[model samples]
Target chain A: MNNPLLSIQSQYWAVRDYLSPEFVAAGDFLTFKFPVWQWEKGDPSRARDFLPHDKQYLITRNVPCLRRATAVNYTDADEDAEKLLSFLDEAEEVAGPDGKPRGDDDWVATHIGRGQLPYLRITPLPTQPLANLNIKDTADEQIDEIPDMDEIPDMDDEAVGLEEEDDAVRIVHPSAAEVNSTAGQNLLQVRTYDCLISYDKHYQTPRFWLYGYDEPLADSAEQNPLTPAQVFQDVPADYAFKTMTMEAFPHSGQQLASVHPCKHASVMKKFIDRMEAAQPTEGEAAPLTSGSKKGKWGIGGMVRKVTGGSAPPADKKEKEPSGDGEGSSGVQVDFYLVIFLKFIASIVPTIEVDSTTATAL
Target chain B: MAPLQFQPLSSQPTPSFWSALNSLKLDKLKLDDSEQPMEAWLEESREIHDREKGGTIGVSGSVGLGSGAFGQESGERPPAGSVELKGVFKNYNTIEEFKATETKKEIFNSVADSILASFETNAPQLDTFLLVTFADLKKYIYHYWFAFPAVVSKPAWEIEEGGLVAAEDQLVAEARKLADDLSNRSGALLVRGPAGQRTAAPVKDATAFFEGVPSSERIVAFHDPSHLPDAPGWPVRNVLFYLASKHGLSDVTILCLRSGSSSRIGRVSLPGPLSAEKPTFVGWERNKIGKLGSRVADLGPMMDPARLADQAV
Candidate 1:
């Protein structure tokens, strides 16, 4: 654990070949390449100021993708290859105009290969095999269980049994860096446990390559499997590439059908039908409520009245008592007889009738 | 009757008058062949002068009479009484001393307020007033003094020292050396006479000439309501009023230039002719336009009728 910072610095040096001089100069001014999170904290207002205001720090992981050997070779052999070569050569010529070439220049030459040399190959570690190697197998008998744990079954034995049940399962742990200063003069400490078995150089490029892996001997050369010419040589052009032309899918025609069949059409249709049935018939009106007229009252007026907390004034109430005979219980009464008796008493032309009525009573 | 003592025997008796006597004398000497020569008459006049010791009057009296007669001979009338009095007394007395008075700080503040009020009352609101002050009448005099010659004559610096001459005799002699130097240095000489002449008119009163120049170029006055009077060396109040009257600038702002400092602090809005309201005053301490949290004094229309009516009683 060389402070981990040194390792990070070395990683920066490794990728320095890819960066421009201006970028390197900028990096020299900055302590490190700012992470995206840190970059986002930059305030535009203080941009005019010399110092950056944001103090928060962030770390970012760097993962390099390897260029295929065939692509590199093709690019070199092609007519346009001279352009790329010239650019690289010009970059090299300008690298150390007055002094010896820096380490980055050497690294660039090695990665891209100098003159007629082959390009570097990179392969990532076989994660599955490495993880499997970490699992202990107690069934081998050479593995012994802990003497104090009679109640507890051997964990190694259980892990081996579980591995048998699902070969994909594995336990993983961090590995130490594989420093090989004697073999290579380079200061970088390569991780040997994570190294891949793939060849470092091939006549044709690999399907996928990771940076920094095993080198193959010159005598063990084999036919490249990942070349496009080799992979598609037997198939017809249309089938091999799957042509997607405008003529095949014209604008006037319906949109191209999905390659995967739609399984839920019937369910969708049922739902649509149910929704259509639930829709109201024409001319049917919606029911009105007190809330519907709330807008007319307005928030201010409503708040005033509600907060006042008093029954509405009698005059303010619009409901009036009805004069019709209908009441709490509807009862038909002799309105004509009552009116006639009142008339007989008020005007004595009705007095004779009133006297006769009294005698009859 | 007196003439009878000398020679009374003529039958006409000299007609009892000089004409008769002169006729008798003419008869006595009668034998005319030619007119009398003017020389004899002149001799006789000389004889009379000699006898009278400078004619009937003394030499001084005769000289005085002669000068008086010459004076009376000219038809030009004397100046009217009031005009003469004005020229001889009033104008001569006070023209040099006439100058604008120094307004009190409080009066300036009030003026600023009034100008602001006027701006609020009027339309087409004015925003700012730029006041340029001269130290005193001297500076104002200098500007006009320099400007007049620059306008009227060929630049004095353009003319050679001896080659250039002024039109007026007074200036010619009085500023002879100055004119020469001015001419050599390409200075302007305010020559008079006709457009192209050797003679130049006498220089009029410089102050009056300055006062007569259009006020626009000489002074720019603006009334800003928001200007503070107490601000050092800041003539916010006076400037506001001057601009209001001079430029008819309403709602003009007054900026205070601090003493020993070029920075502006207080702003006064001068009211227009139509405005009678007070100008809004804001100090530099209240707001900084360039810096954060600086307050700005906003003096817009003060009494907007519509806004006033819109307010609930």
Candidate 2:
């Protein structure tokens, strides 16, 4: 279809609707295959010693389906500073065991973790059964029978004009063209937080068990590997989970510590609201579906008209529709995951500490 | 301090601090009402008779009235469930007085300063909320996130009809994106008019107003219902409760409404993570509610964590 000059939000909804449940669920690590990056001498990525196999580490266990290659890259061309701000805004400000005053013990970690393992409490993604899927259908059989774009309704115009100030939704997901753009090549692998779910017996509330790691990738000269102890210094005293304690896993053999609770559920609920707001309204027109279009309004007809009455290139016309065939769900799941992580990052306990202070020493 | 030691879930036997407190038998007083039924009556009689001579009790009054010396012969009556509060009407009186003495700019500055000052002192460390009501002719709602400077923030101190709508839209957009981020959600509420001016106001539609503001996740709402005209005189207690229930919030730190007549703000029961059965209520200036400064941290999730442990197990 002709590019409808869709805004970031419109694009986000298109991508969300384009995905099916099976594709989102397929984001599990069992079937993940990493894309090869350019190797350089003395690069940290060469550190095979600390690199745990995919299954061994918690970060890689539930790999997000959307990779840098498949997703749309929305980073602005101008303002590298703004891009960095976005990164810093969304990066987990963890103070692991590596920073400041070589103390007898790390107070920051102990204070927040309530134990050796500091939890990263993630809000679970909202899961809905596919519209066409049935319980009895086999996975292989159902994959081929996914619905056409025409079947899905568009967002309601009234919903778009919702006067609520809280209706703003940011689209961080990259589209196929955007991802392939020149600016997308240098993008860094987004950091994934390591955490386990735990419980606070006193309040009887669920808690995140933060497990710190060095960095996102092995090869990176600019980034510093964060020790588990270093992650706590950045945590503010008032975060909700900062006051929780959890039972250590059977094999961890870690000591118990006090916790400082952070109210992360509030953050999670906000994400849930955003997803709710982005939902497609009933009876709205499907913008890109050819079946819904008439005459020259169709993408092919529009492309033909643009090409000055000459036939459009066969290869260009053959390019499958925006969200169809393989990897669309992977793209969708990855996009949602990124959004979730960004929301999670915005609330994580990260208090700025002055390096010049005596406390740092 | 020594490092806290971790133990496996199966091996840990210590009860949580909350569980230990709950186990105590502090519900009923040691002395029963039946045991001390007449004990209170005897103490009261002694006080009346123990005074010095010519204490203005029996010297000027009649010595005989029926069988008793004094006319107040009936037994003490039990306390009333609710009192006839000098609130909405009192507030109206106060607003009139305020308008007579203070300019609109002064009222705005004082109200804004009161709210900003509260963020440092009265505000809870987490999940703070406040609602400031004013008696303005134009009905506008101004909101701010405490993380930003209270002054020069969007929907400035001055009341603007267009700004109120713009502020609502901005808040809704931010709330949608950030969800519960402190920088995006926690802030003040500036409502035009005092508690009683209910007709044709933006805030009359409780659902829309409550939903528009970040009531569900706000840590503080600086309420000042100062200049409401023709009001029925009801406190903004119902609106506060509505915001609390939206997020299933159990604990919230609210600023009591200020009256034009009194310098002192009304009292609100700032409880320590109160149970749902006993909700927080705002009291009049003289009749303060719960204890002062019962500040609490964010209570986190509403559900029991034991169920989560079971599910994980």
Candidate 3:
């Protein structure tokens, strides 16, 4: 073999470790598992530097769930939803002259550690978008974290968001201000999921697991760990039915509900092509220039409000990769997990687990 | 001022702890429902650094137990850099046994007896938890509950909330070292200080430690896992009981030494107390859903033979 060195690891395996200042402000943190099945100590085939080099899995714990996936109005994504506009206006007025949002105390309280009881938040999981909304069944709606509304290249990209309109949970993460104020803390309860990403030796792709907890019933105050069926309520219908399976976590051996990675490579490839295509065009990198100064949460709401429907939503166009995708201009292998999470966010719509801003490296 | 109430500290059982229980079941104690000694720990307060960068905040500590908890005789105190948590884990032979409230109450009474005995012997301790569990070997799901008992003061303890504040780096460092120190962990513990100068010594030795120390410096420091801005964690309540009843102190200062994040310190008043015979107490951990009942971890979906067979392909 050309390389027997354990230090010579996959470029993508190393990138998963570089997640930035994770949730110290957000009350969440990463849990890392070291590789277990390593070459024996005296084995001659063992790589020189160390035996088990790469991390086996990465877990971001207590990802607070403030709302349920079903609460997101998919119709809002296709329409000029006026309800959210006034809230956006409040954010804009309070935003600094340069568009950077000032740290408003109430805003922080509502978003940070505002874990409302996720069980109470759940409505029955909608398997398909309500046909009455008139949203196109074939529309490849973009995820909600996009930076600019105008950035969506009309239609027909090679890579569509994993969230196909009919089969997916919509991506519009309503700002805390968008929720009815009367619901208040009385309605909000804390339900959390532990999001785990592990490399699959069988599939050679990263596997995802979401372990969820639900509120105790009113009659008895005992713990009710989320059932597999209930956990899927947060998952988009397309992948929920087909890809998710209950499996043993390799590192902890805790039998947990998991998202199988069999189709991850195909979805990730489309993601790469689109991300690369979106990278080259500074075409009116106009909105984000002023928008980024507004901080992470404000980036989308501000852009959507500013665009107000004259422009298309923030979807990416996936032109066929110009063959040179493997070159220096290709997506950094380090950023593989970030994009994986971004796409995964579409699949599990209510989780506040991913920390990536739109300019994802 | 508000009645001093402690936010119940959650039991954070590490994967290894659960796995350790699994090994105990599979190898040695398959059907044995006897109690076994276990060692759990609370972390010493860390310096203020991570929170400013990551903006994360919450309860900073839990009764953290790992693999080494079982199968060995443990000392009364945890080693340095850790706070004392001497616990006992009882594995029931069946889920029915695990759910028996009468049996649970008897076990709880034993824990309370030990707490009272420890206090009576002039070595008061509140770092005790009772874990009643049932591990499903075939399915790999575990059902468990934790109870941390604390004696209630007769008239109730009043608290003045000390909102979140940046801990003095040097003072917290010295106090953290003492809280984690083996020699200082036993008996009642307190950190006496005069601004920059502070030291951790047994509460019994509070009189000696404060020879040159000011009255404002008599601070009882405990490893607190509470995330709330005002209320301290459960373990501190009995300490307050000891301080108010035994030591004859009315107003007390407490340092809720939270690890890995900010620590809260506040002044509390022991309003009225004096019933030594059989003190009243309250403790029973609520399930994750905030209810006082049993919680389930269903592993059939993952570990069932049929599912395993399906995934093998």
lDDT (C-alpha, whole model) for all candidates? 0.19, 0.22, 0.50
Instruction: Give the TM-score comparing model 2 with the true structure, all chains together.
Output: 0.19
**What level of docking quality does candidate 1 show?**
incorrect
Residue B245 miss distance in model 2 (angstroms): 78
lDDT of 1 by residue, B1-313 (tens): 0000000000000001112112222453243312111000000000001110111110000000000111222111111100000000001112122111121122223333544454334221122211111111111110000000000011101111222111233323323333333332111122222222323211121123234343322211111111112221212222333334434433321222111112122222321142333223321110011110111100000112222232211
Winner on lDDT between 1 and 3 is 3
Q: i-RMS values of the candidates, in order? A: 66.7, 32.8, 20.0
Query: What DockQ score does model 1 reach against the true complex?
Result: 0.00
Q: After superposition, how far is residue B139 of candidate 3 from its true place, in Å?
A: 7.0
Q: What is the lDDT for B15 in model 2?
A: 13
Winner of 1 and 3 under TM-score: 3
lDDT of 3 by residue, B1-313 (tens): 6676666655655444566677788888877778888777764322211111234324234465655577432111222345657787888887666666667777878888888778766566667888888777765567777777777666667666544345665666677666556364442368775655656777655546656555456788776656555667667777877766666766777777765436677777755656656775556665543435444444444445554564444
Ranking by TM-score: 3, 2, 1
lDDT of 1 by residue, A104-214 (tens): 212112213433233344222224532342242212112322421252223233222111111111111111222222213221111100100010012110011111111
Model 3 error, position B274 (Å): 4.3
TM-score of 3: 0.59
Worst 10 residues of 2 chain A by lDDT: A352-361
